[model samples]
Target: SAMFRDYLSRFSLNPKQKFKTLSRGMKMKLGLAAALSHDAKLLLLDEPTSGLDPVMRDEILDILRDYITAENKTVFFSTHITTDLERIADYIVYIFKGRIIYSGLKDELLEKYCIIRGGEDDLLKIDRNILIGCRKHYGGFEAMIDIESIGGLPSGVVTEKVTLDDIMIFMNRKGENSCF
Candidate 1:
């Protein structure tokens, strides 16, 4: 009961509120309260912040942060909100279709890959083999390549940091010829 009360207090949730009558954020808070009430050391969450407003979503992230750091617990979180992934996840496992494409520390993955942009001439100058995935638009081309492959690229191209969302998009567009 104390555990339930504690989590509820953190989320500003009232104890007696009917489940269906509550807002989306309230419902998620209630669910979290119930899950953590039994002294749960591991939380397996899928889209935990879905349908909630930005403020509520950030509050949930804060709660999870405190849960992991202060309490030394583990949260196996799943969400489409890439910003949330950047904020809360220390590691990332990327699953495209049924296969695991990338699995390891989040920072390492971000460090390992980057997006390079340039015109068609740029593509001709660099080795296409370096690209994990690439797209050619009307004006130019942008490709996801490992940071290790940077040396093989042309001097005039623009390279930028790749986020988890960007990797996901590139991986989707990679098709059957993926570098995996």
Candidate 2:
């Protein structure tokens, strides 16, 4: 919080002389708000939201939407902004060491993986091949599955909806420490 306080202080806002300051709707606001909205058609952002407040994050998203959806520009931002990604990213390409690992649409990513949870005995009953990655809990095992082979999962293991973040974590873990 202090870091944010320090950052905000850099702006030096004066409550008294409000007229001296530019309006929020001014072009400077648009530019500073969307630094990526320059002549470059493609934007390559890295950790753009790592230190932003929630309100600022939303504001940045607004700026991005204005550029991408309204202005018809292309963005190539790399972020852990899963919430933002769900709303904006049309395609995601997982990269490591300049190599591409997976590239596809966001919706397809959610559809491909699922979380299966059950007791160890219940897990033993299910086909091992269905499991992609697993984490042992106090009472049960939570597993990520690429359930393409079977028509449906086993009775003991219930399939739960997986988010994009879940799939990304599963893929990263499955790919060892090298996935990007």
Candidate 3:
């Protein structure tokens, strides 16, 4: 009872306020408080920050960080917002079209993929099967590729580090039949 009351106060939730009257952010905070009150070893949160303002989102993230650090807990957070994942996740699992595209350490995933950009002629020289996703513009094409798959890149092609958002977009674009 004390723990629940403490959490409610910590989240600034009014004990007298009816649930139906609470805003989305307030509701999320209440949920967070309830989850923490149980002293659970694991937390599965889906889009906890969705529709929350920046300040509130930041506060939630900080609370999550504190939760894990204080108790050696594990949090499985799923979200479309890659920036949130980048901020707090040490491991990542990417799912696309009911398929698990990747499951590994966040750093390893970042290391394994890259964005490649080059003229259309240069792009044509590369095998389509190796490309994760490709977008063609008026003069050039940009594609996501596994770093290991690149052997000797054509002269005009440039490679850049891939972000979490880039990986999601490209992999989703590839769909079911594509390979990475």
TM-score list, all predictions: 0.91, 0.71, 0.87
Residue-wise lDDT of candidate 1 within 1-180, one digit each (tens)? 988898888788878877889998888889988987876889999999988999999988888888889878889987888889899899898887989988999999889889999987877887767777787887778888889888867787999999988888887877533322
The digit string of per-residue lDDT tens for model 2 on 1-180 reads 443333234334332444536444332233333454244677777666556767767766776776688667887888777888887788888674578866998778778778877876776666655666566777678777875743565677777888777776666566331111
lDDT of 3 by residue, 91-170 (tens): 99998889898899999999999999899789868878778888777788888999987787898999999999999888
- Which candidate leads the pack in TM-score? 1
Model 1 clash pairs are none
Query: Candidate 1 regions off by >4 Å?
Result: 175-180
Which candidate comes out best when scored by lDDT? Answer: 3
What is the TM-score (0 to 1) of candidate 3?
0.87
Clashes of each: 0, 0, 0
Model 3 Cα RMSD, Å? 2.9
Clashes of 3: 0
- Please identify model 2 stretches exceeding 4 Å from their true place: 1-39, 96-99, 150-152, 175-180
Better of 2 and 3 by TM-score: 3
Residue pairs in clash, model 2: none
